[model samples]
Target: MKALPYDELRALYRNFLHSQNISKATINTAYVDTFYLWRKGSKELFWNAVTATDFENEAKNALIKALSENSTGNVSSLVNGYLSHLRRFRLFLASDGTAEPSVLNQGKTANRAYTRKKKMDVDVPYPSIEQVEFYLVKWDGLENYHLQEDALNKLFFELCPKNTDVIDILLKASTLNDFYSTNIFSIYPVAKHICALDIDTRLKAGDVTLVGDIQYVTIGDIEKNFYSFATKYCSHHNPLDYPIYDSYVDEVLRYFRNRDSFSDFQDGDLKDYVNFKGILIDFRAFYGLDKFNLKQIDQYVWQLGKDYFPKNYGKKNRGDK
Candidate 1:
């Protein structure tokens, strides 16, 4: 694991992120935080020189300081983001001949650090059917409803023309401009990837293919963008067909399952889209949500998340607004 100059490594990582169409603001923040930690230990530390233990320790110490300052909630998110950046950078280095696969594999410490953060109890009451109905009606009655629905449907189908039903439901539910606005470049590529998937055929055979299928959602490490689109798309088209699996939805799942029952299902678990969908399906049945479509159920869960996990679901957060 020979060390490479910190500046050169950072530049390479940043350029990779840029090539992947990551926003400048996000890239800058990740770069600054990553370098800040690198400099804290050694002014001229190299990529291979910093072990996973070192990164983990730095993140844990940062978390401790954040907790002492009563900024754990915000700082936890930042730490997670930094960890993601580090992992991606390590992978980039490995693929580009700058670092060995063994050295890159050593960067797995961040996951442990993330798991150690204080967990929020999301065991809130589920949203009632009346609540979901109320919002659905309100969502439908918004100003220029038809026009907005038309535009959203057009964009969604353009990106994923094969999923007409999903696109139609999405237009009726709400506009997806927020997803498109942020992931303008990645949308088509992701759509193409999804289009090639044989998930529909598998589903027809009563197999849970979505779990293993939808890799395009998080392609290139641009996390959450895929689920964000899928949730809205599937819920709109056929809620029962594809349940949303966004962070808020996961919080709702965690709340219901409780820490003792099942571990928190993170974004990573969604690669197994079948298992992810099954959880929601079983949850719907367990709670007697059979009468409501999966999209409606998602609405209930998402609203519950907003109410109980305000820090994670603050009004300013982007997506499906």
Candidate 2:
């Protein structure tokens, strides 16, 4: 049986450690690290191939491979510490409650487990086809998002691909502004400015200036920089080149940069579409995840951030997608 089916494994493991009076720190590590690999990193294809025969070595190897990018000096010790729980769980799986952890560690075991510092870093596993595919599944199953993609695609591509008139620009901008909860109160001015610029040519040319700052005329002549929304508009038009932006994307990138050092980019850099797309490119390359395109990458990264970093989502729907 695959390791993934054991949804209660974390609880069971935690209980076992507690019974042995294993340090709470160690128990917490068991919960968080396993979540990275088993919950987030476990692939059905990878785990299905795993069996009771040499399960420990196989599991260890898989963990190492998955963690190779960010493998640390103490990775071996950490993996063994992680495996302590898994080995018993595997036995319980094979023997069907005949060989539970309760039976094995009957006495008060030593509490000398090495405990990783709390939030020293997030325990996100390295990105792979499996993890990305998991988020892709979530994207497909996500509410209102896939539908929005279809409608946006039809409007931007089929109906009005070019921003030649104010109506075309207004409809596109307004729909996206509302769709994402971007909080653009004065949308018409932005649309007018975009319509004046040769937006189609700039988009086709991959102009970086399309991202930052907009000075448009009309009602009261206010200046606003709709960076994230601009990226989304461009991305909807050309997802291949212009990857979408939002706070969720920004958070995920920063988390990875801190966790894996995949790309060196400041938080403000994500506001620039060209820089953001480059950092994403760097991220894919660093993680050996070049198999997926920007569009696919965007879906998974956005979903992961939405799922994990849940602060201020309702108040600011910048990452609504």
Candidate 3:
């Protein structure tokens, strides 16, 4: 039987979240208020909201409003993260119908949760090896910069296999690292599962924020172990790139790559999401290998942005230091 009404449950969860000591400066007030209202108004709507078009539209509108105010470029990322939190909470509400609303509310949108897209998949214009080499030979040829699409297409084709596990590791690890760094521990396993997919299509069609600016390296704990081991053993260590995910990578991806998705992603959001295996496959083909095995190339190439570079001298966040 239900231990309490959904309203009380949500209140309890809110207290629980405070007890956990997560910061509120990072959250969207409107979104959280909406969930609280939803919990109090009608428990029946949570089920319909998950797959309902009306709810999606409402959520989208709320997101657009939130974005309009966040000129600092955090709107999309925050909205995507919050919507994901709402979706998962709704799902759990539908299941046992017993969780405290506060427990459900403990969610911080860290990653894209819209993995199971219903729409028919579309073809992505990935690039070819020959074309990539040709572009490299004459990179200055295209003044307009539409060449980025071709480069990414080529990267996608080369890196992602038709169906594989390496892609799983990248997406899972990248997002998981994002979450752990941001202190969003509840969604770590969910991030891990999102990486394993039947196709590269999952991330491309989702309704959530993209995973960007991730520092998948660190010093302690089982979660930090993978990046820690890799960073320590890898010969290409860059002491200056201690915080690893500086604006250089973000801008390169935004300007040259034209990938607004990653540009809009945040640590909290990326941590909660599952990525398109295909996207990771392609990412690995182009960027992952150098990052995974050799550190010098990744560090050097990413550090070219001299103007925006953060002083690499700060003490590492406990995880990465």
User: Which candidate number maximizes lDDT?
Assistant: 2
- Per-model C-alpha lDDT, please? 0.49, 0.64, 0.35
Instruction: Evaluate candidate 2 by giving its C-alpha RMSD to the native, one decimal.
Output: 9.7
Question: Highest TM-score: which candidate?
Answer: 2
Error of 3 at 126 (Å): 27
Give one digit per residue, the lDDT tens place, for model 3 in 141-249.
6433234424333433454323246553454344323522434344334334334433334333332222221224222333432333222111111222222333343
Which residue runs does candidate 1 get wrong by more than 4 Å?
1-123, 126-185, 198-208, 217-225, 231-237, 259-271, 311-321
Cα error of candidate 2 at position 145, Å: 0.7
TM-score to true structure, per model = 0.43, 0.66, 0.26
For candidate 3, what is the TM-score? 0.26
The collision pairs in model 2 are none
Ranking by TM-score: 2, 1, 3
